[model samples]
Target chain A: MTNRILYVLALSAGLAVGPAAAETPVTIGMITTLSTKAGYLGEDIRDGFQLAIDQGGGKLGGVPVELVVDDDGRKPEKGKQIAERFIKHDKVKILTGIVFSNVAMAVVPKVVREGVFYISPNAGPSRLAGKGCDENYFNVAWQNDNLHEVVGQYVNDKGFKNVYLLAPNYPAGKDALAGFKRFYKGKIAGEVYTKLGQSDYAAELATLRAAKPDAVFFFLPGGMGINFLKQYAQAGLNETIPVFGPAFSFDERLLKAVGGAAVGVRNGSQWSHDLDNPANKAFVDAFRKVYDRTPTLYASQGYDAAHLIGSALAATGGSLSDMDAFRAALERADFDSVRGKFRFGPNHHPIQDLYIREVIETPEGTITNRIEAKVFTDHADAYASECQM
Target chain B: MLLILEQLMNGLQLGVMLFLMSAGLTLVFGIMQVINLAHGSFYMVGAYTAATVTQLTGSFLLGLLAALPAAAAVGMLVEAVVLRRLYSRDHLDQVLATFGLILFFNELTRMIWGRQPLFMDVPDWLSGTVELFPGAPYPSYRLAVIGMGILVAVFLYLLFTRTRLGMQIRAGASNREMIAALGVNIRFLYTLVFGLGAMLAGLAGVMAGPILAVEAGMGEEILILTFVVIVIGGIGSIRGALIAALLVGMVDTLGRVFLPGLFRLFLPVAEADGIGASLASMSVYILMAAILVWRPRGLFPAQI
Candidate 1:
């Protein structure tokens, strides 16, 4: 009797349902720098991305998705290997989530050549934005130099004529300082590039003190930023000359590590937790509820990446086969971003507003970023014009 | 001149921190003939424990106090279980085992504390800059670090030359089996030495927590530098570790500060900075190489 009832129900459902209602589950391969000193970055972005997926009921735009996460261990070779495994074994339709620019460069070129849609949650390297631009690549985050350029413009707006610049000696570091110089019409009192991950910044801090610039600008991220800020405050230079940086230095996670040292420091960012928008409020509230901590800019970017993918999937009906339709849907960017408003420029990088955030000390003795002013409006990246594609 | 002096002080501060790490590492190696790569894990443990305790109790001193014994206990436990098995093993085996221990401890820390770096604030009294000389101000926390390091060095010196335990340790370093044959409870001695080394590392970690980013795998980076210190200073020699650590610290600090300027005197702006940056990063290793060429057994090899 039960078998007869199941057969009748199955026959009724088959007769009622449309023939075109076949749903394909989308698989996204996320390769990031995890399981190292910089693992927190990957962890944050992963959490943020997962949070979005969770909030969307484990589906993007009414389509189910399987998210495969892998740790790159902050090595380019490891990242490349993981990318290959993702492409070959996993058959991941869309690739996203590389925390470091080096790893992004290593994996993006090879995988994008295979006709996979690559959406970056973080690390918008200039090479990918300019001559190396590809039709499939979409950077949900700002170009690497955007925040630093915002700082430069902010410094110029603040009327600081003499500024000292410092960053780690690397490609991103070079681009950061160059971006700063692009907008700031000021005398570079001194320019220095310290070694990457150099924890003891006393030598550089001493030189910074001696140079006596009106303002100091640095782009030391991760542990480097924590060390620099702590030492800078200890040296009492924070009392004399104002220090400015990109949000990478003064993010929520790092601000907690640096404690009171980073309080009152101005940094430029494309997103802040306190941005007053319905979409941002929902994202932030849901994120804090799930994670029990404030989300960083990285987390925001990851959330946006998920939403971007979701919008495209919704438009294209969970299918990545029609390249034109998928590309058009992604280009439309018809999703509510935590950053308020976002649009992909010609190079598929964000053309969004950058905000100046001040690290403020609350009455409860917690340090967090508070948006002070809009530094740039609808800012397109410098390399977008260079991208012939 | 003041700038030079300040930079020197900075160097001294870095040297002192490294001394704390190398002292423990050198002692463990000298006594046990065990290449414990997990020595840095003790440092990390100390820092993490201190951060957690400090956050719990709202007292920085209490956190530091807690950090020392926590790390020492961990060291003793690891020795009792894992390190004891590796003593008679070959150097390669010991290296492999200790490396596994490093990974184990790193994952363990991650499981307990999560992935984010912990924050340890400098105590209120030690949080500001103090005038080191006329018109020259320095961080009090750094000065305290220098002072504590010197005190530890002096204590270690006296302990080795003036105390029975120290003598036993020195004896063990020179001839382990002979000391065992001479009715010394060699096992207990090794455990004690290991604990002491762990305590020193823990102390360094506790002191360093306020300044450095206290996170997982923090030990590995500093561990390399500590190894360099031991190699350059002569392995298993505290005095050598001390001297070599100071030298390495100063060379590294001063090189980064002044090398670019020196290069600019001879080359164009871009070329000078490029060469200077690379050379500055390499100066400490260069010094290590030069020292090794002159003294292969290290500058102060212990008397056999």
Candidate 2:
């Protein structure tokens, strides 16, 4: 009976195959956290990658490209399952789109094992840059701590005598604080680690209030950043002690949530929507025309990843086996990156410029970041030394 | 010295707000014998409702007023349709059903509000900081939350203890079938009680909206704290929930503030900060576990 049922299922599966499967496109599988608190940034990453793909008219080399999206829900094991399905089931030659380090960490290993190339648009984990950097893996984004170190430089440059640093208590959080301390040369008032994705900052706020630091540096991203900023403003400390943070801490999504509170706040970024470059200008115009809102760094990185992969495919004449040719194409890096010229260092991470941005009121009464100064040019990450790769 | 007092006040304020949430959860558990995980969804709904109304009406009072009935209606409808069926089922079924409700509520909220947080203002009357002590001023809005919490505790005590309705509720909690045999219209009672619990949670939401970001998934964070409150206080005991809620809130707030500083004395600042923050984050859960070890059921188990 089981054999008969299996035979029937096999016969039925052939019938379920639609005519749409015959004229197949280049299947590109993108997996990221899309169902939890981090969903907004994940949406930006997905849309940003798709915008580039869409602009290519659903084709990468005159062949239609099919984009498959899977939500990891911020779980590493789940990400691995999705990666397996992408490679084995979906047959995606190049896999991309992971926002968190753990998710990328889980998925990249499996992809490398199968010898399929994985392009990480974000989550530039130190491990991947050094010993973990596979020949097939290339990150269009910089090492995670590069932007944070720039914020650290800005803090020291401003000559704040006493500063307090706060981040969620996690591995990534440790990297952020470590990055800040590397370039900051003054007396450190205090360093704090709070619960990862913690909403309540009252106790920490009370302590910071007591410490009376000149400025507070924080690395709370996504919803955590939104909560921290509102609470900080409500505690009447917004203007009293200036807050220094990175691009991820504030973005188009955050500005809408923050309203007037985000105004005049200085946050560092490698790219802002208001950045005035020829490539950036063209990218911004095209993105706004398409999405009807400003795109964040998540989107920009996603766009860059799509372009990088497309260029690699183009360089190899759309073949997956030419590893040397693909590597050479990626190394030449001859694509229009919205953040300006970014080249992968020896570790396969972008060595790029960082910008310190201040939130300003636009003529249309929307809050947007204005580039204050270029903090780093061809900046290297702190953890590169730790990575022997 | 001054900082200690200020931090204490902050902790107390957070505790009072949490009491509102615990009161609802514990009551639902005590009476209905249903572990409603979606209790936080009601809180999320109430907060979003209050914020949207405030934006539309431009009157904080009106928003608060409309939000009460809106939240109560939503609660009553949910209990009538979904929760009523789960009351007789296993705890696992109840948890699964309510968990599904959480997903539905989160998606519904996102669809309506478009995933951005809505800002509600502290009313003009309660916007300024009050001089609670000499050289120490606390936000008047937070102080109002404390006052409102005390009022809720008093009202719940009167309703559940002194009034005929209170007698019926307690009696029903102890013997649901017996009360129904007495022709008490048990269905009506459950709906009323659930609605009341929802209002309590909604009140907490409205009060907290200005201080916390008013967004979807906001309730899940508070819901975990509310569970700790229920576990510590004794599930189904309103009075237990009140005391436990305040205790958990104060401990959590104080933990976030002082735990790291305590560790700072011994460990390097970086290591201390890291360890301190992690421990502080876990303090309330640790407190709950300790309470469970001492009193397996809870501090004041309503069943016993």
Candidate 3:
């Protein structure tokens, strides 16, 4: 058939270009949600990964790397289809860049079984951190609950005894509240789980006003966060009480949308734009120059994923053969991570410090987070001990 | 009691916005016999135009002014180009074509505005909260919205009842062939009607730009609700739209606020929260179904 001939021709064309280059061509396939309400998050991750590859002079470990990007459509089934294609057709050994955990959980198990390595740029579902963790799976981002748990410690340390809790009614949302409750030694006056993407927060805000908590902790991400924060400020609640959240809520991308309303809000993250590190400075600078916008924590994760894979490829000489050698190389994590000094824990998730960042109106006339203090240092997930792998 | 009062105002504000949207959709469907699924595209277009104009001029009022004509022009242009041909086509064809327009508009807006949602500042005069009661303070902007919705509704009522164009539109809806046979300039009438409908949607979008996140695909989210409003209000009745929008708004807001508490009385907190939320989400559709079961043509059938 003509279709089969054309497919063979394209495959051979890709093969023909490899040998002419200095080294064997490496292909990495990126599958992430690129079209929906949360589409911007995936775009940020993809741009960050692309920026790292561009910085590497279009090579990973001194070899030309061909990156294939596919949109998951924010569906787990679509992610599975893309994963199967990347594994079986493209024959990519390294796979990364999943923005949502539910999609990652669906795709990771299937691809890992097929002997592909997945370095998650974002979304660390709990199941992948504990006994379900695989050697082939590495999460460059913090576990889903890590930052919220740190915020819990921060809230308790600030001596807030009464707090109102809110999150979307979903798995990550529950994990976020659970993480916040883990370390906060305070009475929750009220806990509300709003429908995901529920824009009008008037009813909930009115309820929160009635509860009259000293502070409020919410885990509404993306546009939901934008809507909530805007309404919060409009209601004059921001002036009376502090709002606490993870970095996802108060990130640079969202702060731009939420404007001055986001200023003075405190959030926790493993990476801050003001981190005093050479790699971070370079990544931030290069990202702004290329994208003409400030890169958020999601972008930082993507940049780290690229460098992590690059480090492994360099150690293995652009070859992932001798699976043990490659796994050991990745476990070393010797890359110059934009986050600085990153190393995998027993479950392949990062064992790193969580820093409290406060959104400040910077001298540059933009709102961005500044590193205020460290909440947890050399922190590892509680689930790592349960992972036999 | 104060909470209930404020929640009622919130419901009214939402109902007002939905009426702005549904009034236009019902009108277009009634007069043109064309299901304009791209109605939300007009909303997005209006918001973007307002945001951009506001940014350039630094005047919210001027931005609001520009949104009306800009959205109307865009709507008329679309009517003249794509929708004009599809008017005589089957309902399925019209739906498919208009659905394509939604995608085209969404992507085109993305190309122009980028992925980030645009932020518009409320005019300083409208930014403060007004005391509705001694203990309850409602947002002045939302109060302004309620006022605007009422004014628009009155204006629409007058236009339909008092104006020659309004009579033609009514006649066109009930008997298009007779209007055309009478040399009523049916082409001009359709374009004018669509442009007017588009302007109403634009007005809703402009007002909503400050409150809602003005981004791509926003039109689709609110469009579904608008369809529900029109369906419940009657497919072609303006008065029904106003009443049904208010009803849907109150039911949704109050259900979200009080349902969980009612459930908690019968069950534990967590289980009640889950059950309450699922039911609350279904409350609007259930209302629509109940209304239809009793009156299949909706509350007011727009008697010809």
Candidate 4:
């Protein structure tokens, strides 16, 4: 009778121990633009983040994590809805992976207010880096203007007297031009704000030609950049007036689409696949083996974000009961980044080196960006001073 | 003066492309009395097919040839399978069904081609710029597009006015029941018209592939403009479609070019630029509204 009672007690104890040892995976919600023309942006981020988690055997820093992903479709309202669902319905404490500034702006402010930690793999708007900074917010990506600012500085150094500027009429677009102007003190021949998602540029090109700038600087991301570069080349302006933009337009996949049109064009970036770092080499090789494609800056950002989160999770032993301890751990940012050196400012945005990369045709006859020079070393965002924190 | 000339040429090129897209959409709506939200999907299908074929064969002409038939076949299949069931249904139901088709085709392209935008380079012969005048250089490919648009317009005119199929199509558009009573296979006729419309959209897609990023959902970007063109031209009237497409295209292009400069004369440069860009995007829509107010049945309503 005593043996039977002891066996029942042992079985119940085993059940309790199994549940505790296994532990419910800490949930991380990712709302990203995984559809529309910008879908590839999110695909790279998700793939990179998944790679890190997969490396940890469905865990981050030896802590099991459940990642719930949903498509924002590049819509602000849709992103907000997904964030709400993740926060309330799923009871997720962590959020990440938004590709567009508008969607991030709409979703981040609200979620951070709800006491959920938001790690941005991409899309670091200036406002959030400034007065809107929150303890719960951290950006593994550079601020929206950082890459553009690097190009602006490079253009100024190149002795371009008059440069024409163009970007979509949106917050990020405005920030891009502002960032360029901060460094480029040359004469602005003309400035144009195009409609968001506009594919055609004939009319704009006509005026640009008339303006007679020595060079052109544009920030049309994704498919917009592809159309612009092709048309720019087709118009016979490429040979006369050089073109430059941030790395968003000159990503690996986009360069393939732009072909010879984008060759010789200079773009600013914070990370490259060929960065001379052990961590970067490992990442590039592993990513190519797993995904069978070159990783864009976005993929690098996602990988960094996952590792950053992993560092914090490791320090806290994956426990989030003490918010202060978790926040402090994240602020430490104890991870070896693929970008060579990376750390967060007081605003939780990245303070890192930026590089000027030139599009070149490899011996294999494929177009890709190669680092030409380091533009800035340990550069921080202009808005960092405004963050009281 | 050179800048103005170049801008005008740009406007003409844009108008020609719009005509190609609107002609097919107007025909389907005018004849079948069906609202097809998925008209753009056919454009996407054509582009994807052309891009794939061009990459494989290394010949733009072969890609164009393949895309036309492929798009037509897909359109015919969709019409016979899905659209046929929605013919007698309410306009709302047709809209819903065709909208579903848009999602279907967009996702289908993604599944097949992956998410990356495909490259479609301009044929070597059409890669350079042609000097229209001493100082005005234009892309040869765009010139070819204009020429192609004119050829299609002429061909469509001859097909509709001179061919027996054209008469049958026109009659069917006006009175489907009467045409059926007169021994015409109305269903087959409708299918042919849909195929023709899809082919024209396909042609637009193939031409646009060289200039634009040939990616999934590319159709929807220009689809709204196509709708505006058909609405302004009068539904089902090809002549009106031609005129309206050019008009809308010119307005859109010129507005984008000149509006900010005009506004700068009065307002601050910054405010003027912002307002001008916003206004330029709205110019076609505003023109459509004005046209609707003046001619509620459109510029040329079908009078049989």
How many residue pairs of model 2 clash at the backbone?
0
Better of 1 and 2 by TM-score: 1
Which residues of candidate 1, in runs, are more than 4 Å off? A1-22
RMSD (CA, Å), candidate 1 to true, equals: 4.9
DockQ for every model comes to: 0.78, 0.49, 0.59, 0.87
Candidate 3, superposed: residue stretches over 4 Å from native: A1-22
Number of backbone collisions per candidate: 0, 0, 0, 0
Cα displacement (Å) at residue B145, model 1: 0.5
- Model 3 chain A poorest ten-residue lDDT run: A16-25
Q: A140-171 in candidate 1: lDDT tens per residue?
A: 99899999999999999999999999999988
Candidates by lDDT, descending order: 4, 1, 3, 2
- Error (Å) of candidate 1 at residue B244 is 1.2
Q: Residue A296's C-alpha lDDT in candidate 1? A: 94
- TM-scores for the candidates: 0.96, 0.93, 0.95, 0.96
Model 4: runs farther than 4 Å from truth? A1-23
iRMSD (Å), candidate 1: 1.0
The alpha-carbon lDDT assigned to residue B275 of candidate 4 equals 98
TM-score of each candidate's B chain against the true B chain: 0.98, 0.98, 0.98, 0.99
lDDT of 2 at B288: 92
Ranking by DockQ: 4, 1, 3, 2
Model 3 clash pairs are none
Q: Report the lDDT tens digits of candidate 3 across residue range B1-304.
A: 9999889988988899999999999989877889999999999999999999998998989999999999999999999999999988999999999999999999898888888888786778888678888766677888898999999999999999999999999999899999999999999999999999999999999998877788888888789889999999998899999999999999888888889889999999989988887787778899999999999988887877
Better of 1 and 2 by DockQ: 1
